[model samples]
Target: MVSFKKLTIRDILFRSRMAYYNRPSLAFVGQEPVTYADMAVIVRNVSGMLNTLGIGKGDKVALIGENSPNWGMAYLAITSMGAVVVPILPDFSGHEMESIINHSEAKVVFVSAKLYGQLDRKNIPGVIAYILINNLQPFDESVTTPTAGMPYETPKAIVNVDYCDCELPRPDEDDLAAIIYTSGTTGRPKGVMLTHKNLVSNVLSTLMIQEVNENDRLLSILPLSHTYECTIGFLIPMATGASVYYLDKPPTPAVLIPAMQAVKPTMLLSVPLVIEKIYKNKIKPELTSSSLKRKLYSFTPTRKLLHRIAAKKLHKTFGGELHFFGIGGAKLSFEAERFLNEGRFPYSIGYGMTETSPLLTGSSPKLVRFRTAGFSIPGQELKLLNPNPHTGEGEIIVRGANVMVGYYKDPELTQTMFIDGWLRTGDLGYIDSDGYVEIRGRSKNMILTASGENIYPEEIEDVINKHEFVLESLVYELRGKLVARVHLNKEALEKYYENLKHSAKDWQHNAEEHTRKVLDEIMNYVNAKVSKFSRLNHIVEQQEPFVKTPTQKIKRFLYKE
Candidate 1:
């Protein structure tokens, strides 16, 4: 019921900060949290400091960091003061970071201490200064900054602007708030331009599906740079007076389990891979550890019971208070979805991209279907273009208030993104009679078979990933034959060898033979589940896991044969 169409990012900040003035806003685990009152003053100080550095409205300010309270504060400070923020993912390689910096022509960079070394501003011009985010100190005195010393500590020229100050070219609902360069599967990093309204629209529409309030505690595991996290995980929490906790390190099990207990997060937003890994690597193995249990797990009624038992333990392991477990960025594996549905875990799958303000079609935990991405959000239109007659699948085109304005400065690329009036998602899906959206796969990832069958490799990959020994798998075409490169779990492979009697000369030979047999079994198992055209001809073992984008999506461009 909260209307935010006319509100800018700055307006949202002032409203929420004043309303929840003394409430905790952001914190690191086991550390003193920053209250809304504290964040307001900090954001104000940081904005005043940026202004002192000659940074003004429409100036590009870049931010790169691991997920932390400072990162969240910096984002607010940059956008609230009318400067466009360019958020670079922490996982971006040195070359990738340099490319983004050079392309964006950022006047100022606010980088965290951990990822500071990646910024090579050797010959890049127009860069005014690099400010360290943690302490807000001058990162580089060599740059042509307005002042040499700390402006955050003591600014030479400070313009104290009130929330209702009248000024020309000030932060507006239509003004460009952030330009996020997407590290997509296409290998082209294009800047996605989102306005204050674009982001706030998503935050408000998301609230329609789920409620976040002052009493809510959120454990943020995804990168703050990602729109999925930036809008839903960060902005949504800020708007509704919820508290968010971030981890200084990566979200490994050892680090997360303890943090979950400490924070007792009421809601968590994640990509499918994170929860899928938890289900695959931990819960499933523990439940079917014995032969008798495996037999019981094969039956539908008994499998549901086993999944329910494991899901209860899993819920407690995540601090026992998680209500809305929102998964997005990629499709949830059907096997994993069945587990969550049967186990009665409060999980919801969201489907969208950075260009759509990261949420176009999604459901709340209670409204979710087993494998559907639910209906379009409020104020959005979703329709299929050129849908197949039989399957009813086509490119999922959308037009919505939450959609990005366009790709930054690249008019050609921006023009190409939209067709007629709707933005071309390039995702293949269909709307069911009941209005549930089922995404088949990306249109680019679909393989056109010699027999003229449209095969989605992702669907096959999902089946392949369900195998116990298979950690992950990538399905691709090789010389007109479907082949999969599988990354096996070393421990699971070894366990297979331990449980079986193999005719091999030595331990090494036995392990190798057992691995080959296991991969073959996986291939056969996956083939049995898929249609004939989708069957994999060969299964090759990969020594290492496939390199992924920040959100754990496999960089398909890197593996193209």
Candidate 2:
């Protein structure tokens, strides 16, 4: 076994092959699994192909695709050979994708078939070649043979090391490994420059807290372009020789339930939205249907017993072998968190951003505290800066090996984000005496009251979201007054109306009045619980669900006044 202390990703790949050569490594659920030996061959051939195309150390290669075995292979091949891998989120629009490709100055691009149409060749004229991720076929003027119009010859796989003639340059610990562009909720996207050391160090540090082994199986659902998934979901599992399964389609309940049963995954990586929806739509209805059931759920002892029963069913639905159900990307809803705690689910919360190689703090399932995102990972120091006197909340700053080198090509912007070598996270949080980190909200999103009080909208929104008729809520300050934009649960509201026969007469008018009344009721309910400054002055009905990032975080800037 090789020591992770000094090994880069390339070294780890070789070690994995030497030890678990024939073990199942990566696969799409229901698809044939790729062994470590085969994966090595693919990576080697891809590297050889890139070499033949005149790409080498420090060259940028953009990989845009949904999660697949090939996507993972392409990432390993690009980074292992001292080149930078630029992963574009597949959800990005055509213009956004082109902007990233041009901005990153990627010499070569590997795109999936589904996203191939998004690339405007004229926009990204700098790219020398474009290869389809589904199959390593190149499309470029340079790819044609000297005979003028003949397709480029695809590189053949070389199995025997003695017969191969490809030079693989070793990446230094500080070498730029990836340039991940932030899908910023506001402003233009900036590429986050992360080194090989940043990623490898974070991987090891995460494994120290959350133990994973060769026998562990991971079912990945989050976008691989997101650092949270790229690091822990893909890299950690690869480092530990764990088998990772990707969904063949979107991870909706219809597809996910069957796949879960098949994979029986030991570890599952997800954002809070997925589980929260399940709790709201599936579990909540069942719990609140009858007076007796509602009463049973209100009392502590009986509620916990009900939650335990529900949790067992949920566990069985998630393949029954789940040891770690890790959640991150956004704050988990209060109602869902309570159920998870009472039910004794193995789920835990993590907090980090793309700039930190995404794992700053995480809790183990056994040691998890409700609502907190666990302690800082080993080798990282998380501290609150400029704490408020009344409330200890302050901007979270972190310093560690896991931190990125800087934002790519934006030294001025990068300089502003750091103070004395510690990266300012911009997220407001507090660390308890026991070392758990509880995030309040983004510092930028905090509302400053007229009386000089700082109000976190997330806290208010959490309360509003707990209402039966509300699906999601956003709190923003409008002209120094707190206001809420809420997207109501249409299904729940319709069900309510259907139960009243008189409501069917002039339903449209009646529903409008009913909605207004409910919104007013919700506002009063929230205002009564919160402090005077934190109370919402108005609640505006949002006709549509707020647009969200890939992780399902509402794009706050999009809805900003």
Candidate 3:
């Protein structure tokens, strides 16, 4: 019932309050929920405190914290008053956090108690005050006089004891709203400048494709600091009057299973890794455990029927009411996507980056195509640049209301980010005649062969990763030859060896030999599927899982030749 005419975050909140004041708005899992009415009060109170601290329109404020009710409240409070919010990823190292805070020239910082120690006073000299996110209290920086060997009290109360009476500023649609530093896989972080219109426009566009009702409940597992979750998981749901629950801890199996049952979420948004892990570690083994079972799974009719049954169980495991299970952040494994499709799971794929307020193309469950990122979103103009005639592959560029303004304080970087007014997404992909966008890979990650053929490593890695014993794989060029560094499924490998113990005379030697054979088999399997130029010359076993960004994408630069 919220008014769709609202163009800014502040106005959206105001209209949502008018429509659904008594409706549940936000909650931390296992904690009491906050109604829209209650949230309005907290946001207003914190806004007043910020005003008293001299924060106002155009001033930059930094927020670093895990996803929580308070984190959302702090974001709303700052942006509502027309101030710029710089959300730092909590997983960033102390130095990285300090660098961003200083670079943004944030006047005030709202930090979680757990990460308070990461802030260095000397590093962020521009910050005037630090506020604790948990209780919305100010950290005392003034020296306290000792009395009777006990230090005098430092003022902690920042929120007004009485209801906030200060009037909040209304931000223009074009006014700066946030500065989100990108956690890119390579290169220094760049702060993407987003306006009030950029975010609100994306939210409205997303709503056009996906529906969220007051009755719908959302289970938020991604970090709120991430643009994907911030725009879709938090703001879009808020605009629709849907309640969102944040996990108190990481969304591991132990924590997520119980939370799903308790929340009974109707919408679930996540990166591909979450579902891929579940499919590979749990479901795949069950389906391929025995020769008979594997044989049963190979037949199309029988396989589809079996998958449908398994999908029902998967649906129940994810709270049973999930109308939409959105997968984004990265391409989902083919094996997992096949399972979801065969089982008829209500899942869809999305594609975008933080620079686009995080959504440019997404398919609803009914409109999804196999391996495609869906059609271009409404209100966005998407085109392929410098196309290859034969393959139709090119860099995907977009121009729309959701597009970011520019990189903060970096004119040269901003200039290179756009071409002819269209934002260069740096992603290589092609749109089919049917209008489905199929991403090839990051332009920077693409390898050029000696024959001048463009090879997408992601395509090759996908095939490598489908092997049962391979947990994940990174494909790169070494000495002009295609090489894949694969992380084996240690647990699955151990279990396989244990099963072989009874059959082999020397299990250790046989295990090593078997590992080599399987590795060769995996290479053969991948090479058979890919083009000649994409064939792997070697497959090395990675001892550890690759380091990943906040959204679970591997840092490919670290493994680059």
Candidate 4:
């Protein structure tokens, strides 16, 4: 258990010191497992370096990278020193990254080697340096003559610095911690300003629910720029003295599974898409085999026994300490919930936005429910605003210490996002008698049926995702009819027979045939379960995955009905 410390600079420094003193043996897995004491030393050094560079209280410092121990260390060093940290998303383009750096008024940027060239020095104003994270190939010298000392050529462009070892600085808890930019359903990305108190409060509150410990190991693969990853991945682990691991490459199953096996993480945190894909591609097909096999597996006695065996095998694959599997970022499918429930898996679901330090509500170990995003978290006050008379559902409004100060330099947008004192979540949901919040869908994503009935695209997409051959699917309306564009699994199709040539051209032909077979079975299966209004009108094949967020949630705004 973490020793409760006063929420101050001294307290965080105390925590960092405790990590060095007590949990020095703990390992953070990246290219290798690094000790807590070593990490603290690095943080201290980096802080000193920042202080030497004249970066102190309230100054914005930018970092762009995928998830890694270095990213977390950099953020901690910056925030601990009272400087505002601006984490640029790995997916951001050169223009987008530049805009954020300029808008946030970041004096210096620590960027990954892969993205160093994305910086068009001309666009970034008032920036003193662009520090290469790993090692950028020393800029091309052929374009212009090289600088006097630096490897890069000196033009009118901005100066680039090479990041090296540094000492750490300490910041007070009242300081502005970070400015996280979130691209909403519409309009430009808005930077949500969060203070150290706002972040540390949410981290502690989340830890109260997640119940992590020094013995626990967290595997972090989500974009560090996102608030969800920032709070849960970095802060939660640091406070609990738990070690963190991150994938070196993108989190595709090829890279992720190997990393998971190597790390054997005690907790796996992810959005719904990751597990949804596993269930759709891996589990659902086994359920749809032969009628006899399906019936045998569905029997209560047999199914429960099978789940027990599967869970045991899964635990072994996860290094025998896998206690918690957290799914958030989007609503989970009911079918997937049923499978996990039957397996008695130790899984939890949560719901939040970047504005609330991203943890408004979460499930407890003893009180987890599959359908709801769980009860309101500690320190958070939740209320419904303007319920629909017919539906009894309304927007989820939140007020808490974890809530952000406001959108950076965008008071108009910030004002619109909040109502009175509560942060308007824009999610349509209702709190049940049990105090659990059940979400229906985003208010902006709701579609109207021809009969004026409201339909949630997520609802239909959930059903379509249960298909065996489908990797992903997006539900939308086209020409006044509900349509689903399904992305078929190319590898799975070819592997279906072990020697089949299920090429792209064959996808259109095979997709129709496969879709017909799968859809017929699914339609017949789900017909009795859903209302007449919830049925899909058509299903189309999509060649590519839908554009999604870092969490793998489909960008609804990019797709039209």
Q: Each model's TM-score?
A: 0.94, 0.95, 0.94, 0.86
Model 2: ten consecutive residues of lowest lDDT: 145-154
Give each model's whole-structure lDDT: 0.84, 0.87, 0.87, 0.72
Tens-digit lDDT track of model 2 for 269-353: 9898888889999998998798899988889999899889999999999999999999999999999999999999999999999
Which one wins by lDDT: 3 or 4? 3
Ranking by TM-score: 2, 3, 1, 4
By the lDDT metric, which is better: model 1 or model 3? Answer: 3
Candidate number achieving the greatest lDDT relative to the actual structure: 3
> How many clashes show up per model?
0, 0, 0, 14
Top-down lDDT ranking: 3, 2, 1, 4
Model 3, which residues run further than 4 Å from truth?
Answer: 1-6, 141-163, 502-517
| Segments in model 2 whose C-alpha atoms lie over 4 Å from true places | 140-163, 502-505
TM-score computed on alpha carbons, candidate 3: 0.94
Clashing pairs in 1: none
Task: Give the worst 10-residue stretch by lDDT in candidate 1.
Answer: 148-157
Residue-wise lDDT of candidate 4 within 1-561, one digit each (tens)?
A: 454455543355457656645553223343545556666666666666677677868899999876666677677777877789999888888899999999999987877666766778788877775554442222332453323233211111122233333333455566788899866555468898998888888887887776887787877877879988878877777777777876666778787767778778888788887666666666656654567867877688886666666656656666667788888898887767766776777788899888888898888646787688998998879988998888888888999889999999988978898888888888989888889999888877788887989888777777766655667778777887766777777666656634455566675667668657655655555445567887767765677777787667777667675
